[model samples]
Target chain A: MNALLEISGLTKRFGGLTALSDVSFGASEGAITGLIGPNGAGKTTCFNLITGTLPATSGTIRFRGQDIGGLSPHKVVEHGLARTFQAATTFPAATVRENILRGALLRHPLGLGAMVFGGAAARDAERKARQTVDEVMEALDLTEHAHREAGTLAYGHQKRLGVAIGLATRPGLLLLDEPAAGLNPDEVDRFATMLKEIRTRFGLSVLIVEHHMRLIMRICDHIVVLDHGEKIAEGAPEAVRDDPKVIEAYLGADHAK
Target chain B: MSMSATSSAPAFQPMTVVWIAGIVLAALIPWFTGSVFHFHIAIMVCISAMATGGLAVIAWVGQLSLAHAAFAGIGAYTSVLLVTRLDVPVLLGLPAGALVAGAVAFIIGAPLLRLRGVYFVLITFALNELFRLIMLDIPEFSGGSSGIAGIPKISLFGVTLSNYQSVYPFALFCLALVMGLLVLIRRGQLGRRFAAVEENLALAESSGIPTAKTQTIAFTIGSAIAGFSGAFLAHYVGFISPETFGFQLSVSYVIMLVTGGRLALWGPLVGALFLTPLPEFLRGAVEYQHVIYGVVLIAVLRFLPRGLAGLPRQLSRKGGRG
Candidate 1:
């Protein structure tokens, strides 16, 4: 009831190495929550765990206070939690419109007859896809490239399309991993404004993983710092940045530097 | 996928459409051509296209299925067995064969769709051999290696079409229907979803396109087409041997698709049109016709990565840059 998503004592192990252990976090509704850490901080592994790309070794993930652990990846999306990848995951050959339509395929739970023949359910899906396309394209300023192959877009546009695809599933909670990872400063500024507008318009509770200090500090309401697969600090952005453990995790020892 | 044809290759050229039209036209062959014997071979190839279209789906998704021939065999045998044993009408038998084939594909897809890359092709190749063995091992149903003879031709409303006259147009019509369905699948929401799964399963899953479900749909559709073709094929020949839908048939279907280019719908048609006639045309040099065919496909693959339909676009890209 207090959170849209609740994870308790989550553990993930790959053979001898534990990628994540005893990790617990809760995400509230309609707020931008930032998860930040140094490289190899297990930020992505956590994303993987919540999205069910990798099953938890042991733990509980509850969405809307209902246990959703051990669900299939597609079912995770169906539960109204969608995620973007750290690496850009745009389909190279499909046009931007097609790339987005694939996301809209999840909006309905229609069966084979509707899927095959484009019955009323299929037509309804198309209508929704077109509307979502118009909305996201305007939000992300990608309408001009809507018909262009996603791969041919500029690197920054490709990154935005990746986010747009995540947005397409109409997630109650959206997870963005490194949205501004490969963008230039100018593009990052533009992305920040777009990101703000998305939160305002869609009313989505966004859990974004970012390393860019400026973007996170400016946009995140609350911040969680991860250090070597451990939760080192969690607080308001200003407080987390000032925390000693956060500084050490990011900067490492001054002597070593 | 991009609408920027950016080329001067007539009005309708952007790779996928050309192949779609080509395969569709393969079904329309009997309408124009006059020779009854030509109709016989063309109808056979058209049936071959149904199975190949299914293979095209598998290959487009970066999966290879050597047991394509096996599914065709399953379809042919199922319908043959049904017609021979149950006295079911040919119309009923065709769907029956397709249903059995689809069920078999569902079972195969459950296990094989999980394998990675070329591992699937290897597994399918083994399955093709296994199916042939099963056909021979079960003599009562399959008639052993001898196969079932005098399998009834496909008929409608009690009208027997067991000859070249009936089977040729029927095969062509079925081809058209299958191609139409494939085009719709490619153009429709599910079609795009399958392409997405083929292009990137991880991205597809993250985007909420059910990967397993989409793969199953594609496999089921592909298998159904294969089985449907087999039913028509059994009747077209008025007899069937397990050998007809075996390794050589699988190789030919893949060759047709590859020579034509895999994603292009027309690829299989062009492949069948050219390859189906070449050996017969050079009957005197029959010993080396297949070698020539292989050499030609090699040249095409090297030069036109998109297949025959891709040549003009590739040339124009060079021409524009030049």
Candidate 2:
């Protein structure tokens, strides 16, 4: 399958500290790719660069065969790439439905003039947006909590809401940042199953940044490991799990030996 | 189950009727009292509310601007010059003022909005002062400190509103138009976008909302409204001066916005209604008028953090629990 997202020679530096160094990977269309790394392994940095949350020091990020590097976050999303935050980021005060609606509206965005002087087109767009929001919420099991404020949600639900928001954007490629970070074992299992279900249902390509090895290993079709901002290993989950480089990165070199 | 609440349809509530009645009664106050002074005060409220409405738009995007008064001044000057010099009709001049003010906001907003929070406020404050000094320097247009006097009154189709009563209705009409526009915007998709950007800029951006552009749009609309109100004030008051739209004017607008509910659509109107006639009532203690204003502002901030417009919501939330 052709790659939905391609990153080559990606590098990010914060003055003296290099956050990501010449890391490169491609997420295939209709497949789940896991980016696993230890704390400070530059996994989040990769997500940020891919989503245009931060400017890359040097690299090219291609989405759907077009260069999207250095574009604004909104513009990157407009290119059919959307991302969820490490934390369950949302419009805290807005209801779950409202939060998802904001994301869904991106699909049927009305111009300032069109919004102010609304017509049939605007109404149609809004109707379509609401439909998308309903579908997204239902798929994410957030339909029941639609009226609840996102900030007031339970921790696991909030994480699911984050994914719901990303899905609402109708993205071809979805990047999730540590989605299962704080979930309990049962929640993680459910989340993993949901991820797999959504991947096939939506026909989406996913690049997930996660430290939860079991969850990542269970769901990811392919895995890439990063250590000290560099790609240490890349292959199927089983191969990457046994890679000495990945083991050393997760555990210390002494522990690995 | 449906997201119909996100749509613009007004859900039936008893409070809605009470609000409409209150507004209608307030609008008819001048006629009820049969007093020219009441008419004048009512007219001032309309203009102040309109300007404050503009400020509220900027506030909606979670940015407080001290340059609001400057935009108003830009409008005032633009309208005054257009009418006095080029012989443009007052009706046309009003919108001209809005256009110029909005244009200025659009130009500066891209760079200016980059500075968030207090820094944005400080820069805007400096911009307001700069506007005053520069206008003062250009006495040929601004009439120096003494200012322009005997400006023409608002004339529609060659009918000059020569009296306070006539002008009051016209001002009310203009206020209604401005408020209507505000309502249209608030009920539309742009309002949702504004809410998203306001609630969380980062999330909004990632959600494919162009936050910077959204903010600039809000600023432009807000400043344009300020401009229209400033133009109206110039024509009705029949004077133009650099000091008219100064730091004090901006601060008063902020106070009104904060006192009413920074994020509420009716905040500006509520603030203007409550505050404009206040000094008139406190005429006995004229010297302590601002001190009283300060106290009221502080008390409101302390208790009604969402401002007066949010009072209903706060009370209802409390009621629901109790």
Candidate 3:
């Protein structure tokens, strides 16, 4: 029905450096769409622009047909678009469960019932969060480490927790920057499966940036390649894989430049 | 396993009887001791601790506010004005001053809160200077540099507190009230969201926790508590001076929170108690007390990054992270 997220001719710049130069793309509901590029190709910058973490230099970002440009990051989430950062972002002092609960609790405006007493609302919210945490952990196979301090997790798990926290928001559009960045091969395979589960189970539409080509090629329904801040390729995975521009961007950088 | 929880709420359980024992010990200190002067200093410590606990919210959320003392000044002056000009009962002034402080914090914090990181810090520093200058101009209201005088004592439920003699326990009561609020916030979702914003603002925002709004709400609440403390302190002294609410007072607040542990509810109290007694303890060498305090702070900052209550936990976390 509704195309989940629509970004048209979006441009963002940092001082003189044009980080995202008129990049345009769309991701539909229930599809795993990938944004792939070499380092400094502005994948994360595009993400920042979409999530409203960074103001777009110019152009429109419409989430389910609503213009979401210039809103602060929290407002972006409120509008049903959520994102996972490239950095290992977690409340280091908190347990994995508390981290997820914080995300779940953010859905409410007043947080009235939960804020006051050890009242029913607070307990209900917490129980729901605990259930979601358990389900997400099961899906990600991180159940055993539920009570562990988030900072103590291996890098890959911490990265997944960032995504889990985002998933807890139950966003209509989930933008993930480099979800598979530092994972080993086995972990990447596991994460690809997790991504598929996230999409299917949550009915989520995803826009992901991953430098890990194998994971992208395996799980993505479609792929878009960016070269020097421009969308160089976008198509079904097979066609995009054989793309000469994608090839040059990834493999033949020096000569192509 | 926390040792400072005062309440019995299961979900937000703090350490119970142990903390009560500690509070009981604190209550006996003034009665058991000889010097009224030391008791006065201890009372100051309690008041300052309560105010700094409020300031901790601002500091912990990465907002450095040098205008805490100024907000307290607003509270103190408001209390004085209400008592002197309006002839309001002194008890009315406490809540009135607190409400004004909260209102002022909201007004000032709303605009300046758009400034992040060190910009927030600088704006607050300038705000302290501005507030002092404003006090200077409004001589009719604040009594200028000479400040307000003959401000009456707080009469709680019809019992008029005598300055110095009776105010020790009243000041201590104010300290308890402020800390109790702090403990509630610290154990709740608001506190968690605040900490989340500090850890990763972008992540917090993406998670739909309005980071800036959270900071502003915290600032408002914190400033309100500071005002409440200010109201009590002003009446306790029976006088108010702009100098008492200057930038140095802000630093003193900062020093207390920083030394105790900005993250912990008790950190501000510990910092105040530790530093408040140092001048008296060194007595004849009062001049060197602050110098040594400065050196000690440097040493702690270098070695104990998270303040005293947090040190052992930090080490254990480092071990676990490794």
Candidate 4:
């Protein structure tokens, strides 16, 4: 499969400390790619760099054959990329449907005129936004909480809502930051199945930062491991699982048993 | 999911009736009162409310602008210059002022909007002071300390508005137009986008929303409305002065919005209506009026955080259980 998003020689530095150093990876089109590591392994930092929330000290990020390095976060998303936060952050005062609708409305390019006027073009845009919200909420199993304030949602549902919000943006590549971090075992299993189903159904490329090893291993077609801001190992999930570098960096020496 | 609630249209309700009645009463104030001072107060409320409404828009986008009255001053000067120096008609002058103010706001907002929270507020306050000083310092164009006098009365489509009563309807029309636009904005998609940006900038940006542009749009619109109100006030008073739109006036406008409730659509209107005629009612204790105003503002902010518009809802909720 061709790569939808390409990152090469990526590095980020904060003063004397380098958060990421020469990390390289690509999320292939229509596949699930996982970035796995222990705490402070630069998983979240990598996500931030790819999403344009943090400036890269040096390197290139290409999305759909266009250089997107140094672009603003919103501009990055406008280029067919969307992301969820490590924590389930949302528009706290807005309803669940409204939160998704805000993302969906970004598809309308005419700005305020298209949003306010009831012209044929504006009406069509509004209809699409409503439809996208409905579909995303239903797909995320959040339709039952559509009208509830986003801040009032149960914990797991907030994570789902975060993913649903990213989905509503209709991105070619979806970046999920620790999506299964706080999910229960059963919920993690369901989330893994859902992620796979979403990849196949939406034909989307997904780059996920996760600590949940079971979910990552069960669903990811390809895996890249990071340790101390460096890529320790990478390959198909099974190959990476047995790699001595990844075992030392992540699974520990006892992982062989 | 309750899809039914999403699909249902808003019903014709008591609030609609109340809104219409309020507008009608505002329009008839001059005719029923038959007093010029009453007309003057009514006109002042209309102007103040328009300014307050503009400030509320800025607040909606998560920025508190003290430069609101500066925009009004810009409008006043633009309109006055067009009429006095260029001899343009008042009808065109009014809109020209709004256009210029909006343009200036858009230019300033592009850079200043990068600063968030208290830093934004401090910069805006400095800008307001700068606007006043510029007006005071420039005598030839801005009329200086003595101010511009003997300004011509406004003529709208052939009829000249010569007195307070004559200008009452026009002011009422301006207020209604400004307030109506604000109401439309609140009900439309713009409101949702503004709320999202206000709630979380990072989340909104990640969702593909251009947050800076949204803030700039709010600032421009709010400034434009304030400018339009200023233009109307200048013509009605038949004078223009630096003191007419000063830092104190900006503070009052902010107070009006906050007292009425910053978030609600009717808050500024309720604030302007309540506060504009208050000094006159407190004629017996004119010395303590400012102190009283401060106390009342503090009390409302502390106790009724939602403002007067929210009072009905709060009351209903309290009475519901009983």
What local lDDT score does residue A190 receive in model 2, on the 0 to 100 scale? 91
TM-score of 1: 0.92
Please report the TM-score between candidate 4 and the true structure: 0.93
TM-score for chain A in each prediction: 0.96, 0.96, 0.92, 0.94
Q: Write the per-residue lDDT of candidate 3 for residues B262-285, one digit (tens) a residue.
A: 777667877787777877777687
CAPRI category for model 3 = medium
Give the local distance difference test score of model 3. Answer: 0.80
Ranking by lDDT: 2, 4, 3, 1
* Clash number by candidate, in order: 2, 0, 2, 0
TM-score of each: 0.92, 0.97, 0.92, 0.93
**Comparing 2 and 3 on TM-score, the stronger one:** 2
Q: DockQ of every model listed?
A: 0.47, 0.75, 0.53, 0.61
Off by over 4 Å in 1: A253-257, B1-34, B285-290, B315-322
Q: What is the lDDT for A235 in model 4?
A: 91
Model 2 C-alpha lDDT per residue in residues B1-322, reported as the tens digit of each score = 3446454345545765677688789999899999999999999999999999999999989999998899999999999999999999999999999999999999999999999999999999999999999999999999999999999999999999999989988998999999999888887888888889899999999999999999999999999999999999999999989999999889989999999889988889999999888987776876676777799899999999999988998999999999
The parts of candidate 2 lying over 4 Å away from their true place are A253-257, B1-12
- RMSDs, each prediction? 3.6, 1.9, 3.7, 2.9
